[model samples]
Target: MLDISKLERRWLKYKIKKILPYTLLITTVTILGFTIPFVLSNRHSSKAMIPLKKDAIKVKAPNTENDEGAMVLEPSMHFIESMDTPSTPITNTPTSSTKPAPTPKHSIAPIASLPTPTPAIAQTQATKAPQPIVKGKLTSIKRDDTAFDIHEIEDRFKDTSNPNLGVYIAKYHYDHGNYSEAYNYALKTNSINNSIDDSWLIFAKALVKLGKEEQAKKTLQLYISNSNSQAAKNYLDTLDKGGSK
Candidate 1:
């Protein structure tokens, strides 16, 4: 027995020192392994690894674009952003995104025989055309002395078998600019009707117009729970902006 505890302490220290260098080396190797692949993938792509044949990867001459997929449509980010905003114009002049001049336009000229646009006289037809009608039906409820009593309207709507009578009345009230009454009716009707989102929205619109901003916000949040229309989104954004001057 050559002082066993001393030997054990020395052995542990030696093992720890040896293990620390290898552990650091392993960690460095793993970090490099992940980072190298991530950086390469981001900065440059490996086109050679792509399975497209040479024929499929055809390139057009300089100034010409490959138009095989020219008809394919892409959604624009600018269009999406503009949907919710009044667009301030981008002032930067764009680089020419066009390819080489189209061959049909390049060779064609006023000297060559060409078809003329139809004259206005030729385009006009001598027939009466029907006017466009919007989808909503106008309720006879008037803004004059003959408007429906709010209580009677609410009571009648409470019991009416017709599902849309309440909505029709809400729209009628909204059209008349009776915002407080409209909000009241919509709020009560929505509570009675069990999550009718449209009613809640009419309430929200009225609240916004009436300058009850917090209530309008809550109403919109409730409505947005059930709808994704751009109209709803715009209304909610209007509420967020504290309404227009």
Candidate 2:
């Protein structure tokens, strides 16, 4: 029995010696697994407690020098609080319409025509009553032989004091084969202005045309004596020879 007991003790000692190294290795690995993660978690928590700048936020960055999934702290962006009210989104879609708007049109107004003003001489002639001699003389004068219309000249004739108008009237009558009217107008011209030689010559010629040759010569002689007019002298010599004007 003593021999058997000694053998059993030796075998048990041998088994314990062989298993002890593997037991220590498994125990150390398990402890390190738990302790290393706890240490890493504490390190990260310390980094989170570090002072941060205003408006700054912390973010996790990969740590290349450590384990594959390990993370470290870094200031990545700004932080803002969420608004209490949400903003409405804006869309750029255009609206549709059935018809287009019409363009505007401009309207023009017509201008009114004004009446022509009458001349001062025309107004004066309108106010005067027509004399019978003037009416008869206007009717008898040949309108075709006159340079201007008879009515136009008659308008200027209203200003009797104008000797130029009287002379023009006398010349118009004489050129148109109206001897009686020529005599009247020519005499009227001389009455207004005796300096007009045309009126004197027309007066003498009108007398000759009216069958008063003696009277025509006597009038020419009288005019020549007063004015020393060569024209009047020539006319008087023609009348003396019984020549018609």
Which candidate wins on lDDT? 2
Model 2 ranges with Cα > 4 A deviation: 1-148
Best by TM-score: 2
Pairs that clash in candidate 2? none
> What is model 1's C-alpha RMSD?
24.1
Q: Can you write out model 1's per-residue Cα lDDT over 1-245, one digit (the tens) per residue?
A: 59999999999999999999999999999999999999888656656555445534442222133323222222223312321222211111111223211112122112111112112112111111222433463212111112424344456566652224454356446545677776766666676563544566567667766877687777677666666534456667765775531
Give all candidates' CA lDDT scores.
0.47, 0.51
TM-score per prediction, in order, is 0.34, 0.39
Stretches of model 1 off by over 4 angstroms after superposition: 1-155, 161-163, 226-230, 242-245
Tens digit of lDDT per residue, candidate 2, span 154-187?
A: 4555543455555545544654567898798779
